[model samples]
Every structure is written in structure tokens, then in C-alpha cells.
Target: MRFPFFKQERRVEERPRDFRVISPRIIDILTHLKVQAEKLKRTYHRLLARDKELFEACVRAEQELDRDRATIYANEIAQLRKMSRTILKSQISLEKVIL
Candidate 1:
């Protein structure tokens, strides 16, 4: 009285997943990432040192520029004083000649 369509089919057995195959590959990737991270950290520190050195150089250059500007201004002032003295001596001689 039962039909074949009413009977349950047998289920296929699934194989257990093997993590050993994937675990080593993941470990290798993690190890590579760690090595790369260390290298990047070293590079960043080197860059920082270079930046500090450049800043110090800029400070030295600025100091030199200030000294040069002061020297130029002092020379110009001396020249102006000499010119003023010459004019006063000429004026005094002219007054004596007229009198």
C-alpha cells in the first residue's frame, strides 16, 4: 500500500574539514606581515631622524642670514657718516673764504 516516492533517500556522508592545510598558509602570511611591519617602523624612525637634522640645518642657516644682514647695515651706516663729515668740512671752508 506504500508508494516508492514516500520512502526517504539515504543522505551522503560529509567529509570532516581539514584545518591543517590552511593553518600553515595563514601562519606564513602572518609572519610575513610581522616582518614587513618591523621594516616599516625602522624606516619611519629613520625618516624622523632625517627630519630633525634638516630642521637643525635650517636654524643654522637662519642665524647666518641674520649675521650677514647686520654686517651690511653697519657698513652702510659707516658710509653715510663719512659722507656727512665731508659735507660739514666743505661748508666750513666756504664760510671762511667768503668772510
Candidate 2:
């Protein structure tokens, strides 16, 4: 004989899932993340441009045989490179989250 408990269980299992309730929030979050990644990329490019300018200055200082000025520019370039590396890591991490 058929059982009432089994009929109720089958009905519950057959109900369709509605993703419409959850998709918008996910889309918004991903869109925000993509924007952040783009911003980081722009910042990285700016840093690279600055680094190039500094390197040129440093080389000029060295050619002039000016020890003090060349040393200062070299130190500044090192700091800028370190900062650029950190920004790149952060951008990669955000992209991973978006994926």
C-alpha cells in the first residue's frame, strides 16, 4: 500500500530551485571586484612610469660622477619597485576572487 509520508517527501524533492533571488547580489559584488582590479592595474602602470623616470635620473647622476645624488636616486628606485610588487600581488589576489 502507498504511504502518506513517502508522497510528501517526493513533493518536497521535486520543487524547482529559484536562483533569481541570489544572482543579483553576486553580480553586484563581482562587478565591484572587477572595478577594483582595474584601478590596481592603473596604479601599477603609473608606478612603472615613475620608476622609469627615476632610473633615468639615477643614470644621469652616475654619469656626472656624483656619488651622493646617485645613491639617493638608487634608494628611491628600490623603494618604488618594492611598492609596485606589493600592488601586483594584491591585484592578482582580487582577480582570483572574481574568478
Global Cα RMSD, each model: 33.0, 5.2
**Model 1, runs deviating above 4 Å:** 1-22, 66-99
Clashes of each: 0, 0
Model 1 worst lDDT window (10 residues): 90-99
For each candidate, what TM-score against the reference? 0.45, 0.77
**Superposed model 2: Cα runs more than 4 Å off:** 1-22
Give the TM-score (vs. native) of candidate 1: 0.45
Candidate 2 to truth, TM: 0.77
Candidate 2 residue 22 Cα shift, in angstroms, is: 5.9
Using TM-score as the measure, the top candidate is 2
| Global lDDT of model 1 | 0.58
- Which digits, one per residue and each the tens of the lDDT, describe model 2 over residues 2-27? 78677554454565777566687898
Backbone-clash count (model 2): 0
